[model samples]
Target: MKEFALIAELTRSLPKNDTVVVGSGDDCAVLDLGLPDQFVLFKTDAVVEGMHFLTECEPEKIGRKALARCLSDIAAMGGAASSALVTIALPKKFDVEFVKRIYTGLNEIAAAHGLAIVGGETTTNPERVLISISLLGLVDKKKCILRSGAKVNDAIFVSGELGGSLAGRHLEFEPRLAEARWLAQNFQIHSMIDLSDGLASDLRHILHASKVGADILASAIPISRAAKLQARAESSSKPPLLSALTDGEDFELLFTVNTKDAVPLLDGWKKEFPKTKLSCIGKIIAGHSLKLHDKGGVRELSAKGYEHFA
Candidate 1:
């Protein structure tokens, strides 16, 4: 089955559980902790051989990416990471030193982030290497951001640049957990999501949840320097804007806040995250579709970034 179809089917088949504060369709599943101000955010992600990484790629980097991807989900919720557990599937003919390096990479990052690697299962696959990490985090119930809170006229913003992940940023990108937390504490962020699936596709998730549309200005879209350089080199007809629109795996944060507070947030962001880039590319609308404001015209957004099915 296609990725999204399988996701929908599973979401429907799963029995509703009352303990889930925010369930399927979000970056993380928030569980009720029965505390007035706290919620638990849970996420798990995997990196597989030949798909997520080259079979010849360093095993250590592969292990690091597996854990980082799951941690990105926690950052999307503006949560404080707590701990992690890992599952590994290795080929029967694997070398011991190679496995040790993989864990070495994973342990290094985990220690830096204070994410304790508690326990996990390992098995022999005899075909491909597969590493999965389950991450637990804590969020303030009052401050936790979800994709469903966007309101009409809310300003949309994205952190850092987008596109050209294939140029190598994807493997070494840092999760914006610190920035997300700072934003939640300082600004009234209405809704937030990590830009793992590109702006066009991921923004749709916010629209679906908030029952709102967005009007994105083509000129205002933030194009990463890497994407611009790549576009120039490719000499392809696709514009840099297209790259910024469709390139997934950026791992940046896309969020929305009230128009009134947008100015202050932007003003404070400079002093707070001096090296990070932030852009206001759009505004939420009352409808249920995305419209792009191109030069002298408007058009509906097209199939974007990477989707497993399409």
Candidate 2:
């Protein structure tokens, strides 16, 4: 069964409400709350021990990563983090101090992000560790952005470098909150998505939602330093470009701006975020497939990123 196809088939008939500003398909669901100018954003994400991390990973880092995952969802919608509820499932044989350390790390990050752990639940798992966080956020309706807003001829830009998440970058990555806020405030961003599943896979989410295609100039993508170093060390004959396309977990902002605003946004970006690298990788086209351009000429961009049930 084709994974994405199956997902589309199953969800095609799901019920929906008029109050749902943005529903299950996007990073976070935005719902009308009867507020004059705001919509509520809700998201839930989970990280498991074996899949997302090694069993020996520090409990504190795991806690931080769990919270960061949910916060990234908020960032995608250009919203403000409000509060969260965390549910933890611990192995039967775990130390109390170790658990406390996890909470301590999580609490610190929550406080820093202005999130309150209003409620949660705890349970025992057979031998694995699982942590899930459900977060609530607020976004001004007029200012909110979603994956379905892209238009043909829009310029595509991605914030920071991509790929090489396995080289400790996945655990230490910072969500692009400040960068997203700035983009929303200054630019007429049409669509946005966080790169959690690599550019090749995640870009399709935007294309499908927007009913548009993209033509990416492969030479323009900013591959990560870690990805380049890893390619050199492995000597596997694979290019760092492949990693940038499929490595996933980069958490950078992949957004589109009006073609007219692209020049100004890139120009002003240099002065405001001198440290961050922004690249114009592509343009949104009036179709529903992803195409990549290189010296070899143009071809379809494959969707090979992580998918659980593919």
Candidate 3:
């Protein structure tokens, strides 16, 4: 089975409690935890050598990517990161300096985000290095965003450009933490998710949770220069538009808002994040299918984004 299929099966019978405000199927698991005004956001992510990074990659970048992945999930929930516990599994005979360099990168990013590296476990993995991060965050009860809040006619927006993450953005991209917080604080965001799994796949998460569909405009997609260049440089590479649709690890924010707020959000985003490019790529519809629109007109989008065990 594919990764999501297995996840659906496993999550079907998971244990839960009253404190579980949102569990499974979200960017982070939200818990009430008896907090009067805030909800606790919990997220865990892992990066494996060879799968997520190469052996030749810098240890610092590998460590940074490990933590940044979890931070992106926290940002997806529109929360502020608080602390983290890291677990690193390595071969029994590991280089001491390399391990320390990994922590150096992790610590630097953690400090920049005001997140403390509290504690964790170090284990042995016989073959490759694996770094797992469990992050904790807090969000205002009313301001928390979820994939399930999208509604019909809501306009979908994506932050920054998309595609060609393999070129290096995957290791160094900044989490859209501040951008997500600003959107939640300033606008009535209907729904939000970070684009880690590419727009094609991640948008489906919102649609599935919200019980809506989307009509994406191909021409409106903001393709990254890397994506365009890759297409031009390599005949075997996916076209720029397709890469923008399916290249995972963009780590940008994908969100929706009422159509009435679209103009205002764009205007506000420009003033708030002049360096970031926010594009209104689509709109939610009544059904449960994803469709793409271009000069050729509308058609069901059959292409899927990256998936494990596919």
Candidate 4:
């Protein structure tokens, strides 16, 4: 019942597709279109009750998040979401009104993002409620970003702020679709990922895939006000910046750009995206481990994101 074992058992191999360059086990799955002009991107994700949400949370929010989880994957790939499939397994005791509200929320968000609800299946589960979604998207082949393309000396960048999801931040998060599109159109982004897991765990996905290491400045992380407030109220100590480093479900984009192109690309992005905040917090290096630098000096980091059945 460990996390990896459960994933392997319930979600083994992906459908065989000649176009798939990389599938099923990365930040975003990639598909190659024969044409040099475009490629297809696909990703699937799930939300389970008692894990992703409180049992008492509004049903509408639950549905919105179910779809949001998948959309966030597309956003991470620098792709435009085209369609989605939704599947739900509800217990027999589920309420009719709750199901209706859930559909309402799902449809509303899907429409706003220009995604069509193409198909899905529903079944009864006696244990816990489960919502799973598969999303399809498109990106220019030349512009498609992968998790395996980072290089030494590249500047590491993260979109928007991080941390604080335990304080209701995860429920209201907006996927970085527009920002990702802007990045694709404007720069040669080397690698990218969405921060669904904590930064430490998720960053490992990018580094291990790219065969590169990174050193992040501890002070540069943007901790949300809500995270700080919660930490102080609960612990009677200074807020744990580690929460920003390891908290899951932030839904922000984490990406890298070559050092030579970083300045100009950032300048252009600033003029075009005044509201979305971007921060340069680290650099890709030639080793195999991630290091965090603070006034106290460098230290190894650990993956502290949410782990199921751990």
Candidate 5:
């Protein structure tokens, strides 16, 4: 079965309470926690040796990627990360220096983000290394963005360029925490998500949650230089456009706002983040089918990002 299908089945009957404002199916599980002005954001992410990183990959980068994944989810909610607990499962014959180097990377990012490393556990996996990070964040009650908020005619936007993450961008990509917070504070962001699973798959998540669809202009998507280079360098590689649609781990912020707010949002972003590129690529529509508009007119978008156990 596919990863999403398995998740749906497993979470179908999970226990819940009144405090659970937003649970499963979102970038983060939000809890009302009785805070006067803030909601708590909870997220957990895991990285494996052979899957997320190569065995020869630097341990420091590997650790950074593990924590960065959870941070990106928190950013999707327009929240500030607070603390995290890390659990590492290693083989019986693990290297002490490698584990210490991993912590070096993890600590550096955590400190930079003002997030504390609380506590966690160490276990034996008997095979490859597996690291899981459970992160906590907080967002103002009124500023928290969710996937279910997209509306008809809302403009969809994405931060940074997309695709070619496997060429080293994935491990070094920074979480869009500052950008997301700025967007939520300056504009009425309707919905948002981080692009970890590619534009096609991640955008579908917002549409499904909002009970809507989107019409994306193929020409408007900002493809990365790395993606273009990869396509030209290898005959067997996917085309740049397709790579932009399906390459996972972009880690950029994808969001929506009122159509009227589009121009102002773009102008403001240009001034606030001169180094980053934000693109207005599409618009939300009233429907259930995701469509791509290009020189060929319109067609249903059947291509999707990578999924586990598909």
Candidate 6:
């Protein structure tokens, strides 16, 4: 079973909040303040030693990734990150210098994004290292984008390339803060999300929330050469392109805009930020399932984003 299905099945329903602008399925949960000018956004993400990091990976990178993962959610909401709280569960064998280096990495990224580390907790764990970060951000209430706002005829867009994040893309990916800011200031984005999970799975969140479907063109997905190389290095039977489709942790932005407004906005985006390539991969439709069209012909796509207990 896919991740979302399990979440819907196992998790009990909670009282819905009218203040929630975007909740549960997107990158961050946004709360409305009722003030015409401002809204608040919150997000939480956790990193586990065995699941999210390699045993020998640099302590600094691990720390940076743990924090950056949450910041990416703020970027998705077009919000300015304000403060963060970090909770760490340290294993028995952890050293002082290791912890210090990890804090250094986290602080570096936080400073770069103008976010302050306000408070947190430290705990002891016998088995593995775990880090959880929660972030608070602010946005304009009228301007906040949501996953449920997508229209049937909107054009789907993705920032940067996709796939093979396991080959170091996850470690070094820059959060799309500048790009998201530009998008918020200049364009009318209908909905937005960060592609932490695979594109198929993440896109499904928007579709399901909006009660729509999508027709994605496989040929249009932008793939990095690094992703192709990694796929070739890891497998011989299946095309590396499949890895690009299935591999998660590409922290790029995936958003949608009205079909009429997409072309001009895309042209401006290209002229402004050439490094972050933008690609139009699909269109929203009036249905309940996702379809992918490729050389292999049309097929139903599965929503298989990364899940903790999968």
For every candidate in turn, the CA RMSD to the true structure comes to: 3.0, 3.3, 2.8, 3.7, 2.9, 3.6
| Clash pairs (backbone) in predicted model 1 | 246-305
In candidate 3, what are the lDDT values of residues 52-157, reduced to their tens digit?
9986889899999999999999999999999999999999999999999999999999998999999999999999999999999999999999999999999999
Q: For residues 110-210, what per-residue lDDT tens digits would candidate 2 score against the true structure?
A: 88888899989999999888998999999888889999999999999999998898898887788888788888888889999999889999898899889
lDDT of 5: 0.93
Q: Between which residue pairs do clashes occur in model 6?
A: none
lDDT of 6 by residue, 229-272 (tens): 87568655334445556677988998999999889989999999
lDDT of 4 by residue, 1-310 (tens): 1775686676676477688787776656788867577788878888888999876888888888898878888888888899989999999898888888888889988988999999999999998889999888888887888888899999998877777786787777888888889888888899999998878878888998899899998888877777787688876643457778777899999999999988997788789888878888899999988988887777777685222211
Deviating ranges (above 4 Å) for candidate 1? 305-310
lDDT of each: 0.86, 0.87, 0.92, 0.83, 0.93, 0.84
For every model shown, the clashing-pair count is 1, 0, 0, 0, 0, 0
lDDT of 5 at 54: 82
Regions more than 4 Å wrong, model 6 = 9-12, 15-22, 34-36, 304-310
- Worst 10-residue stretch by lDDT in candidate 3? 301-310
Residue 152 displacement (Å), model 4: 0.3
**Ranking according to lDDT, highest score first:** 5, 3, 2, 1, 6, 4
Q: Write the per-residue lDDT of candidate 5 for residues 1-310, one digit (tens) a residue.
A: 2998999999999999999999999999999999999999999999988889986888899989999999999999999999999999999999999999999989999998999999999999999999999999999999999999999999999999999999999999999999999998999999999998899989999999999999999899999999999999999967788889989899999999999999999999999999999999999999988888877667777546322211
The TM-scores of all predictions, comma-separated, are: 0.94, 0.94, 0.97, 0.91, 0.97, 0.92
Candidate 2: segments with Cα more than 4 A from true spot: 1-6, 15-18, 305-310
